[model samples]
Target chain A: QQQVRQSPQSLTVWEGETTILNCSYEDSTFDYFPWYRQFPGKSPALLIAISLVSNKKEDGRFTIFFNKREKKLSLHITDSQPGDSATYFCAASVIMGYKLTFGTGTSLLVDP
Target chain B: EAGVTQSPRYAVLQEGQAVSFWCDPISGHDTLYWYQQPRDQGPQLLVYFRDEAVIDNSQLPSDRFSAVRPKGTNSTLKIQSAKQGDTATYLCASSSLGGLNYAEQFFGPGTRLTVL
Candidate 1:
């Protein structure tokens, strides 16, 4: 079974606009949530991460809003740029856990 | 500092053939993980180790897959018999458990395997 799930298999937004990608998880034991950005033919890179203790985390123009009670999280890209076009993956893991459970991913496209 | 490195960037094998992939994690990182990513899908964890000791490997297919991190710095994943279903990109990632930055992991370029 897929423990982590992401919505909107694909998305498109204009430059300077804000885009939101949603994610949900089934395991309540999960405490750490991270977002990864991967360009084609490259490895996934860490974008932003949030611990359950916080309701939100931000890095530059990327922000992660997490709702632990709802078992859901969303990644917001402010001022979306064409360079930001890539596949975004939502992942969850337990603190000190050995592995991360990843969602199917969302393909984002930012058009100038 | 160097990032995680993987070798044999691409491999092709016939069914029933055997293959191995190697990975070298960053220095001073004690945790290493392997993940399998199918086309258009997210990566799934296959196994992980903390300083040469496997912490979890429940997702690995034991009948054909095996992995080892004997030196705590490098690891190898071997498949005894290749199958078409095994075609995927294998990724290696590493992270340090020290301080408050333990949640981040560095990934390798990955090895793309194709089983015909």
Candidate 2:
């Protein structure tokens, strides 16, 4: 049972365009949500995250819009750049442990 | 200031061979986690430890896999008999205690193991 699912396995957009990646979870107990980015031949790095109480969290050009009722959330990258092209994973956890349930990653390619 | 560090960045072994991977988490981080990531797939948690005690390892293939954190600073994952199906990248991550759940984790470069 896939506890977390992501849409659009792959995406391509021109530089400066806004790109959106969507994620949904099945576990209601999952209150911690985080987005990670992975580059070729490297480890996945934390990009941004959100808690249940917040509907939105923004850091610079990255924004996360979360809906608790729908059990869904999205990552929006404004003014995307070529450097932002990488695999993005949405993860959730029920508690403050490190056992994360991850979603199938989305491969984003930003063309210059 | 150092992030999580993993050893044997790449390993190749034949079926039935034994292999081990090591991880050194960030200093002062109390929680450590290991994940297996197949090509194009999301990472799957295999095990985790908090101060030398295992928190969860239900996903681990008990028959062939084992993990340990003796001093609470570093960890080792051993595969007794590797199989071709075990080919994947092993990732190590760590987070602080106060931010264990809320604080994002730092990841290592990972060890790519190939079982022929």
Hey, what RMSD does candidate 2 come out at? 1.1
What's the TM-score of each model vs. the native? 0.97, 0.97
Candidate 2 lDDT over residue span B6-107, tens digit each = 999999999999999999999998889999999899899999998899999999999999999999999999999999999999999998867244756889
In candidate 2, list every pair of residues with a backbone clash.
A96-B101
In the order shown, the candidates' DockQ scores are 0.70, 0.73
Residue pairs with clashing backbones, model 1: none
Question: On a 0 to 100 scale, what is the lDDT of residue B13 in model 1?
Answer: 98
**Could you give candidate 1's per-residue lDDT for residues B32-106 as a string of tens digits?**
999999999999999999899998999999999999999898999999999999999999999987777444888
Candidate 2, residue B75: Cα displacement in angstroms equals 0.6
